[model samples]
Target: MRIIRAAKVLTGRQGEVIVDGEVLVDGSEIVSVGPRGSAGEAAEVVELPGHTVLPGLVDAHVHLGFDAKVDPVTRRSPESERHLLLRMAENARKLVSAGVTTARDLGARGFLDLALRDAIEEGLAVGPHIVAATRPITLTGGHCWYMGGEADDERAIRRVARENLRAGADCLKVMASGGMMTPGAAPSWVAQYTTEQLRAVVEEAEVRGKGVAAHAHAHAAIRSAVEAGVTTIEHCTFFTPSGHRFDAELADVVATSGTYVCPTVHGVMWRAREVYGPEMLDDWLRGIASMREAGLRLIAGTDSGFGAAGVDNPTDGFVASLEVFAQAGYGNAEIIELATVLAADACGVGEVTGTLAAGKWADLIAVAGDPLERLADLRNLALVLVSGRSVTQAGVDTVTASVG
Candidate 1:
């Protein structure tokens, strides 16, 4: 058993946090979490002089199979099986060190991610918890054409889903729209999927008891995916030929269907301004604002392997995302929720992992500043724990302890 006391414990739940709190962990579960001094005495106790603690962050969308190399996977040389395994382990460690204890891998090649997931669970290597999706189904010459196994018909998509399930996938991924990674492909907001195909993929995924993430960029594809019952929508970029606008009806449906909208906002918020120039910045901001206003379930994802600019640490990326939202004039509380409680909830593992509740896993992180005041505090993470075991720590003076 262990106890960690801190000046603040942001439970990562919406509206139920505390200042000067203590958390008790036994084995891998969070036995008790409450105000300071709640647990009389413990086997071990660590004090956070003035830092804040919160549940370990979750990146709802990632791709461990691809190394963050120069050319994106969908456009480059194929990775050797051995290389994929090795790279997956390295990516997981970086994520864990960033205080991202639980990550949902949206897509990965072959069966590498599945194997890595098992290895992490078995303690064969150092890594965070992995929720992996096997190879996704895609249309030929479509988004992520390489990693995606091209399948045009319902039978083909269903067949691919079953094969992925057989490969030990925890979830199913489908390329529902064109993506930026593939040259000559449609932009983030161009339509890519037929309503029938999305429906088929969703139905097959349901039958296998696996969740689906529709990689949607355009509104037409996004609407079709939501209507088809996807568990989450990735990179909802709101792109169109001329420009873009919110699909209000689709937004309402997503809010109504309880689907997760993982904007992976960090990627767009960082790149679009530099890539497209300033004229389209307002368009990008408005679309995101609309999604937030409609109360969609948004989560944080850096699209790390995509050469996503501006930051390195996933935790820092998450914090920067909140700041962008704040700068855009969102309420501080709402912006905070997008990275914490909302992110966990959107990933479909809220009950067991998101908050600092009794019986949940003790996945927590501590930082020196108050995120509620200046979002940058979140970037300066001090300590991180996964399953009650310390993965990284900040010294008394507030610097990350070296891994070695």
Candidate 2:
């Protein structure tokens, strides 16, 4: 049993912030969460005077096994897979230090994420719990095809979905349209997935009791995805013929279906544009704001991977997405929800995690100040506890288990 004292507790419920609160964790479950000093006796106790306790962040979209600094895929020569996985494990450690206790990978090559997931689960590594999408299915030569998915027909998609499940994938990812990372491809406009194929992918995953995450940027593909019962849409941008942009019918469909929309917003792209050139980043803000206004269920994702988007760093995206929400006129609570409650819900781990409510897993984070005041305050992270075990704490950023 352990008691974590905090200056305030952000219960992750909208507009709910309690000052001078605390949380008690025993084993892998949260025993109680309430006012600090009020939590009765415990085996161990610590004080975080200036810190705030929050439900550990849930990053809905991430790429664990890829680097985002360069054209990650192009830089990979098939021989560096092992090295890349090791580096990704290090990145996952950084993410855990930043208080991200749970993350869902949007896509990755082979079973790198699966291996990493097992490592973390089996106490062989220190990192966030991962709901990995081993490899996403894509049409031949379509977006992210470099990951080696060459499905162009319903049969192929079904086969790939089953293969991913057999590989212990927690979800199935499908590239339903073109994206910026895949250069020279159709710009988020041309839909690469037919409605029937999309349905097939979702149905197959459903029969196996798995979920589907669609990397859909175009409006047509987004609509097709919503109609087909996709669990989450990666971009959810409405790109039309002739580059006309608007979220169209997909918004209402998602609102009705309760599908999650992961913008995967990271500062790397915009920051890179400032250093590299404003050639891209166009319509990104517009797409995000439009989705927000449409009442779409928005979840946070960093799309951390090798190449054009992420730097393989998960913490960067977690903070960056909060800033994006702030810029879009969202309050602090709503912004937090995009990454926590909503995101965990997106990953199908809502019941087991997300809220600090009792009976849920003891996945929690503590910061030096209220995260709602300064989105960057999350960087003041002090302690991270996942499944009632401490992962990161002030001064000690990384931990290798001690042998008794």
Please tell me which predicted candidate would have the highest TM-score against the true structure: 2
lDDT of each: 0.74, 0.78
Backbone clash total for model 2 is: 4
The pairs that clash in candidate 2 are 67-305, 67-306, 68-310, 72-307
lDDT of 2 by residue, 1-404 (tens): 88888788887878777788888888889988888666799999888898888998988887776655656555536647777687668767767776888999777786888999999888887788999888888877778787666698999999888888888989889988887667666667778899899999899889878789998878788888988998998876676655537645657777888888887776465665565455345566666777788888888787765444433334446776677677766777888877788889889888888888878899998888777888888878777888887874532343422211
Compared with the true structure, the alpha-carbon lDDT of candidate 1 equals: 0.74
Span of ten consecutive residues with least summed lDDT in model 2: 395-404
Across 73-103, the per-residue lDDT of candidate 1 in tens digits comes to 4444677889778777777777776667788
CA shift at 220, candidate 2, in angstroms? 1.1
Candidate 2 residues lying further than 4 Å off, grouped into runs, are 183-187, 241-244, 273-282, 306-317, 393-404
